[model samples]
Target: MSKPRSLSLAAYRVLSWGVRNGTDKPYIPRPEGELIWIHIASQDRQRVVEGFCQRLRQSRPNLSVLLTAPPQADLIRWDASSHPLVNLPSEQTGAAREFLDHWRPDLGLWVGGGLMPNVITRAEERGLPLILIEAEIDIHVARGARWLPDITRYTFDCFQTILATSPETVRHIRRLGVPASKVDTAPPLHVSPNPSPWPEDELIEMTHALSSRPVWLATWVQDKEFISVLSAHRQAMRMLPRLALILHVADMSETEPLHRRLLSMDLRCVNWDDGGTIEDTTQVILTSDPENLGLWYRLSPVAFMSSSLERGSGGRDPLTATALGSAVIHGPFVHRHQQLYDQLNRAGAARLVRTATELGDAVVELLAPDEAARMALAGWEIVSEGAPQTDHLIEIVQDSLDQRGQDHAST
Candidate 1:
């Protein structure tokens, strides 16, 4: 190691110690249940880790997860009420030892990157079962792995199982002296379906009330696309007089304005955020609370996912509605989730509409029972295609934990 690099590492250790013991102590007391610690090094890997953690928690109610990432990494966006988030300590031996001593995690899951060789080696030395997922060898080179090739090899050897994301990564891990049998290429973990939080009775009541009515939903509609959605709804209403539209605004403050706009246009609108009821004459149900999306997705057989119609507005995830049995119709700006949208489009589960007229036509076509059923079934299949992989990962984690328990009991 060069003198400057060694000094930089020493400074990092001192900073880590100060952060831990200073006024902003990031440590949270470990919960009573079996705890699993996940170390995430890059912001790009946070989404996959969050999804895996969500599925793990759902599968094993008794298990708790502790997430640790570098201070600069953008962690998971969703509310992490159950899982506690903390900053990973510096890779210095003392800082790593201090972190492990405080949390005492039963199992450690390191995602993407071998940048923290010292911390990883320290955990393995302490008899912790460490698994590496989505391992990237480029991170090793970027962190100057060539400077201490032997140390890099030793660190890679710590992981009991290494799941590489590509063939190149697999070869890279093999070059680092990891056993060939221990490293295997695996696909990136996909996001699992997270059902919206809505009451069952409310869904039932809304379904019963909207029985036999032509209905569609515009979910997470941004302000810029309001006119387009309204125009599509108006066009659809002309073809089917009893057409009902659910306009779920992305911004809560826009709910009142949207309701006023509908009323000004002589459309019978119901404001859901203000305890307004959907009567027989109601043409549009305006709501800003996204929590009630489950109800709308269930009641409406066809839905248009928003944020996609306008330029520069990257699309929102459509799986949430698809998982709830809604056939999705999206706009042209879905580059953010292009792969997923492409899969759905190719599977005949979703339709892409670039104009308001196209949106209306798609809505009208999917309103038919047979058309809606076919699309919904296809969407459901696309959403469920990754179930086997998710289940397999969960089984591996559970089995590892079980074996650890058995070993402890035997001792």
Candidate 2:
């Protein structure tokens, strides 16, 4: 390893020496396996990183991942049964040492370039292979650090590879004297274009049952929004008598009660989870099985992503719907998936409906074959545009891990 040309890191360590690292040790001990540590500079990158992790798991099979984000990150929990998220210790020597010792990850990935001199240098010293993606380095610090020396280049030596988000970012990194070969321009991470697979026979059967009727899906619907969704379906049906709705409750346990509730609302319905069949007169198909979502996404032309209609029900990820070629409809209260919903809205790939009446109008309008196809095309562009970039990053990570495994074996 080459020595840093400046004493900036040393001065930084001294300045932050006594700062208390607010991060706590996790209750779960480190499992014995090949673990990769991923630290994000901000919370917005959490979903993208999680997507990358999913692909990584598919490739590596048994690899474990540990995710860390800054203190300001208020990430809503999702399917974390396997991957664990924890607070990253503050960039102090003691905290860094304790964290590195406790986790002892096989590899580390720092996203959006929140380089901590203490943590990064320590990791490098321990021979951890580190990769930096979506680099957003503060290059002004290179000249601003006249008191100590070039700061950006000083810490960058720790990373084995660095992929910048844009050509402008590449120029900025290059100006700081980082090797051009190490800095490649890559696009921002996106939700994977390929979603989890569903049973194809079911999609075929559902397609046959529906007989190409104008269909819409309301997924992750909460109990509070039952009336709103039901009312929306009723209003839409006034325009298109053949429109069918798939009402998926967020909580599966509510299936029985929701079924009973729909019956009371005078809506002709079928409970798919209870093995009820969709009849020609069926206006609503109810389900809570997550596995069936993929089938519905492909079957439906338009999807009203529920949980956003009412507050406290964090908005659902719309990428799956879009990736599977369904036009998206969402509400205003999308705190969890704010960025994603905004992206779709801006691209004209999705419609925003704040009320049941508005949702009904939008659904009725979008369910037209041509209208739905146009919107689904727009959404498909949003997800597919980032596919090559995501695939490249996956390859980078896989190669790094493979090389590390070989090195460990040799030693």
Candidate 3:
């Protein structure tokens, strides 16, 4: 390394250390409600943390959650009403101490990797009950060794319970001196189901109006995949003339053009934004409002998750459809959610289709009442499997807080 650059880096670190330990303390009063501190390293895990917080709050209404993440995380995507978001402190003891002193969290839940050894060890020393969820042990251990020699063992030992997402991670943690009993393998955390925003009365009325008609939804369809969706619909329509489709375009601007194209094909359609009602002859329901997806997912017996037909889309999450009781069909390009899709496929909850013809065939097969019902049941099971892990973590947090309260009283 260049001498000048090395000197500059050292000076910057010294200045940061001085500021952290400075006498001028930042004024941050503790909240009246019980606080739980959650540290996440990246925004990719935002959905998991958000779901955990929501479930946690439902069980303990008075509990306040403080989510700490690096500045690069997508903070804006999270709902501020659910929890207060804060930037993570530098990995220095002085900074960590200052943050813990101000927040005074009753418990700590560290999610994902990038463990800050100094902060974690300090919190453990301060009697904080710490739990690590979905720990990436190998990555954390390597990173820790790079900067803080031999700190990995001490930090991994601090967690009261460590939930590793894979057997490999469990092996790594155990090798780092964490007791085998303290660590266990678990599936990755799943996002909590968001309630359907559509009104119940409307849903019931729509259900009656459609009256046993075979229905399918093409969710979040990009313009490039319109041909595939429409072709699949047309092919399926040849066999079941009464089949209805809910075409939800990803872009609102494409809604008008899509409506025109459907008209050009002489297919009867309804525009959701224009308050058009579904009639017996309506073949398609055109919409661009993403919020209304819950309604379609609930109504449709089968759904083809779009954005995966073309390359670079990485596909949208199919779990939402599965959670809402829809049998899923998608294209092969789902690298973004490959693990999820693979699990669903193995569980018989989802099907992969490479071409529009295959998509049509899959839809037709799943349209059968027995087949659709079977897949829907499997999908529901996959979605519900994560509840046990979430509940267990919540119970641990509640127990820790109860113990802390008793200790305070005795003291």
Candidate 4:
């Protein structure tokens, strides 16, 4: 790599490390054979690629995965049943290249965009098979790349297989010289299926502590949505006086203001920031611990995916709520995850509310045992229907790998 590129990479690593304690996620070097390397640019979208790695590992246990992304996705949960996950050193393409050299991944999966051009070149030079899963060439990027046909072709030519989500992606890939035969239509990888295993003791404790109250959760709640949700909770409380509200913020920093706002309503509130219990009279519990959101969702039958009550906050994922059997409710602005929500809504698994009053009404109605159970059944049904998507993708990957191995032996 050139000096400038090397310096840029160094800066990237520094910024990533500074953002969070560098040691929160300790790195483990690559292991053995037939590894899959995934490079992701979007943090939110990284879950899809992770899902692919996880499912692939499930069917084929011996394979390994090396996941490299900068600050956006810095940590790897090292505890999954099979395979290992490692964070790539940011900007240090040399380190990334060296790691790949040692692991010698047979297949690479690049998710999302903005991957440096040289990274693709290095993988090609090493003869490592590359696939871009659910990839698209953004209009701004396509326009810029169009100015240089040679470079654009080189970028597009690097992929051995390309799975695209839309026609525009297919057109862009064709422009770069990939034969139509090599690019296939595939659904975006399913949401990762690993549900948080709520501890039996904790669940029992939560059940005892929070039982008999109608609990509702608003996850990843933002500023505008947070206020609306709090207001809705107050309004909903008129009908269901024992309503328990749980708020988990996308950023931990929002906890203080949210806490104060709840207190101003004279509603009993508690914060999990310092850790505690949900007392009998506690009206709201504010938490910044995201992992706790999973536990809360599992405990509550009704969940409102936040960042959706108002426009501009693109909305949050409802897959976890669905997978955990929580009846989901969201605002009308669910564009970021339209497909998942649409499927759930169509299945009668989730409801869309356009205003605070509507959301409050839905919460009150969903609290009914019969209604909540009905919604839960529908949500699970929709999730159950999509379970095979993960298996199908894994089967495709395995078959392709087996074919590649056979061809290599014949040649």
Per-model clash counts, in order, read 0, 0, 0, 1
Error of 4 at 252 (Å): 1.8
* Highest TM-score model number: 2
Clashing residue pairs for model 2: none
The TM-score obtained by model 4 is 0.63
What would the TM-scores of all predictions be? 0.80, 0.91, 0.76, 0.63
Q: lDDT at 336 for candidate 3?
A: 68
Candidate 2: segments with Cα more than 4 A from true spot: 1-15, 18-27, 79-82, 139-147
lDDT of 2: 0.82
Of the two candidates 2 and 3, the one with more favorable TM-score, higher being better, is: 2
The clash tally of candidate 1 reads: 0
Error of 3 at 224 (Å): 2.1
Q: Residue 33 of model 1: what lDDT?
A: 67
- Highest-scoring model, lDDT: 2
lDDT of 1 by residue, 4-119 (tens): 23443443334433224354465777788699999887765564567678788888889989988874454454433357888876444566677888889888888887457557
Off by over 4 Å in 3: 1-35, 40-50, 61-90, 93-106, 112-114, 125-127, 134-150, 163-200, 401-411
Evaluated at residue 380, the lDDT of candidate 4 is: 77
Report lDDT per candidate.
Answer: 0.79, 0.82, 0.80, 0.72
Q: Rank the candidates by lDDT, best first.
A: 2, 3, 1, 4
Instruction: List ranges where model 1 is wrong by over 4 Å.
Output: 1-33, 40-45, 68-103, 139-145, 165-176, 184-187, 194-202, 311-313, 332-339, 346-348, 405-411
Cα lDDT over the full model 4? 0.72
